[model samples]
Target: MLGFLTARQAGLDDPLRLRRAESTRRVLSLTLNPDRDVDRVHGNGVNAIDIDAVEGRYMLSGGADGVIVIYDLENFSGKPQYTCKAVCTVGRSSRHVHKFSVETVQWYPYDTGMFVSSSFDKTMKVWDTETLKPAEVFEFEDNVYSHHLSPIARKHSLIAVGTKNPKIQLCDLKSGSRIHVLQGHRAEVLAVRWSPRYEHILATASADSKVKVWDVRRASGSVLTLDQHNGDKSKASSEAVNTAHNGRVNGLCFTGDGLHLLTTGTDDRMRLWNSATGENTLVNYGKVCNESRKRLQFTVSRGCSPEFVFVPCGSSVAVYALHTGELVTMLRGHYNNVDCCEFHTDYQELYSGGKDCNILAWVPILRTADVEEESNSAPTRAVGQASVNPAFQDAWSSDED
Candidate 1:
């Protein structure tokens, strides 16, 4: 660490190298935050969670009880020990509540005025954030498994939806109706995601053990189909030329930059792929226990040099190196199977929910000296003491009293 800092000071290393080092150190020190907790309001397990891109101050969660909640994550109390309280909730008594389990919930990318939720009741509802009333409802013939609105799309307001049926549905928020269907999978479509880099690109995973990437503007079939065998017919058996996993592919997420994609399946394996060429990176993220029959919501770190992937594995959330596929750590708190997790880039914090009916917050661990000094008036480092590691000294501010 000192060598990197010395090189940085001497103008020999890239400035990004220093930032990546700091980000890596912070990520490696993550621990469950005992002080911060999202208030519990769901009667059943939480299935989906999302933090909007605009502010990252508010969070949304949907649960099996057919309830949706919005939480104010900011600590306005001006103290270290402050709870993130629920701002508002759409409870079961509400006339607009879903009849069955809410499978997914996401905020509108551009604003907080509207959000979307899909449920097993075969309906996806768009709600006015202020009134908590359904502004638009799109009904499906089968149970809706997952839906995602492109976060970076400027030309389209399309929401890619997957259902119990093999066909993937694309609904346009502007038209308030189902615009088209992309068909290729032979079984239920369990997961769907839009490319953060390209507005026209979409990805879908299915029970048929296949993952396909499509271009919405093309009249032809998918642009690329991910093949675990990489088109090596000799090594491939009687199976199709393209198969992302050997079992049901239930989870899909793109990296922070949308350069690569990460997928998890019921096969107890997670694979990373090159989003452009559809080649499996073949980074072996060993047995990531996934048994969910529905869409599994996972997330990746943003604004970090070497990012990490957070996936729900059994009763714990497994954190792995995004590029190397190394299992960094396992967050074990939920008594039941964890279903979903969302990463907050602003503070390098993590929020997760599961069958335990609880949402747990994970924050980067602060040094003991700093924490102790903040708790009470204690002797910290002297004003003019030379530090053993110059990196800490360079990063630490000198304005403290």
Candidate 2:
């Protein structure tokens, strides 16, 4: 760590190199923080969560009880112990609240004044943040599973929505109507995401065990369908032809640059893919343990040397080396199954929600002065030593029950 600083001070290293090194170090030291907490605002499981890109200080969460909340993540009290308070909420008392489980919630990419949410009640609502009311509501015939708005789109205001119907719907915020539909999947569409790099490119995952990428401008059909076998005729069986997984694909997320895509499935597997060519990178993330019938929300870290992927695995959040498929650590806190996780890139923090009806904050531990002195003296101590936090130790016994 001192070597990188010295080289940076001497103008012998790229500034980005120092930044990446520090970011990677912080990610490796993440643990469930005992001081920081998020207020419990939902009566049921949290289905989705998102951090706003504009300020990164406000977080939005959707719950199975049809509640939505916005939390203030910034700590201004000059204290280490802080609880992120809910600034506002759309409670069940509100007439505009969804009638069923709120499946997905996302902030407007360019501004915080407007946001969107989709629900199992078969409607997607565009909300006015200040008013806490729906500005526009688009009704559908089937339950909505997931939806996404392009973060880099400058030429369009379309929201890609996945639902119980196989076809993906494109809703226009400008025209206040469903403008187009991309038809290809054979079962319920489980997840949808727009590329951060290109405005027109979109990806969709379905229960039929297929993932398809589309160029919405073409209006013909899907441009590519991910094949786990990499198009090898002999290795792929007839039933597995052009399938991304052996079961339902419930999660989809792109790396920060949108160059690669990560997916989770009911087959207890997660696969990485090359976004452009639709080729499976074949990096084996062993046994992700996904059993959700609805969309699972996961995320990736930005501005790190070797980027990391965070996915909800059972009751814990699994951190993996993005390119190498190495399991770095498991953040355990929730007692029930986890459903969603979001990375706060600027602060190097993580927030996860689960069926336990809790939102846990995972913060990086500060490097102690004693550890630094020991590292300087020994110069051979392993950097990846196991954590000594008592919360990490398992205490469950077979005789308890």
Candidate 3:
């Protein structure tokens, strides 16, 4: 660590290298934090969570009980132990609250004054943050499963929405109306995501076992329907042609660069794909244990070397190395099945929500002086002792000892 700092100070090494190394180290050291907690505001499972891109200080969460909360993530008390308090909430009492499960929530990409949420109530509401009222509402005939606003969009103000309907709906924020529909999937569209790199590129996953990439500017059909077999005619059966998974693909996430895409399915599998070519990278993330019939929200790390992917696998959140598909660790905390998770890129922290009605924070343990000294003396021994934190140790009776 000191070597990198010395080189950085001497202007000999690229600053991004040091940043990546530290970020990677921080991610590897993450564990369920004992001191930090999110105020339990949900009576039902938390369905989605997102941190604001502008400040990264506030977090938005949607719950099964039709509640939406904004948490103040900035710890102004200058203490290690702090509970993230809900700054405001759209409770059941609110007239603007969803009538059913709030499936997805997201802060406006450029500002905190506006946000959006979708629900099984068959409506997507564009909200005014200060007034806690719906600025605009887009109603649909089917239950909304997922929705996404383009984070990099400058030319358009479109929000891509997935629903029980097979067609993907694109709502124009400027006109306050459903402007376009992209049709291809034969079943419910389970998930939709806009590319972080290109404003017009979008990806959708469906219960029909297909994942399709679209260029919204074109009036034609999908640009490419991802093929798990890489278009090998002999390998693909007739029924499996151009299918991304064998079952419902409920999750879709793009890597930071938007060059790669990750999809999770009910087939108990997660596949990585090349977004541009619609070719499966075939990175085998062995059985992910997905059982969710609705949209499953997962996230990928940003600003870290060898970025990691975080997915809810049963009752725990599983961390995997992006390219290698190696399981790095399982973050256990929730007592019930985890439904969603989000990475706080600025702080190198993670927040996950689950059926347990809890949102757990996973924080990185800072390197202590004693551990640093030990590592300098005997690196292997220090590495072995890393997990020996007293907080995680179990107590045993004298008889057992």
Which numbered prediction scores highest in lDDT against the true structure? 2
- What's the lDDT for residue 228 in model 3? 91
Q: Which lDDT tens digits does candidate 1 get at residues 179-232? A: 899989999999999998998999999999999999999988899999998998
> Any runs in candidate 3 off by more than 4 Å, and if so which?
370-401
| TM-score list, all predictions | 0.91, 0.92, 0.92
lDDT of 2 at 274: 97
Per-residue error for 286 in candidate 1, Å, reads: 1.0
Predicted candidate 3 versus true structure: per-residue lDDT over 54-102, tens digit per residue: 9999999999999999999987876656899999999999888999999
* Local distance difference test, candidate 1: 0.87
Which pairs in model 3 have colliding backbones? none
Count of steric clashes across candidates, in order: 0, 0, 0
Candidate 1 regions off by >4 Å?
1-13, 372-401
- lDDT comparison, 1 vs 3, better candidate: 3
Question: Model 1: how far is 383 from its true place, Å?
Answer: 28
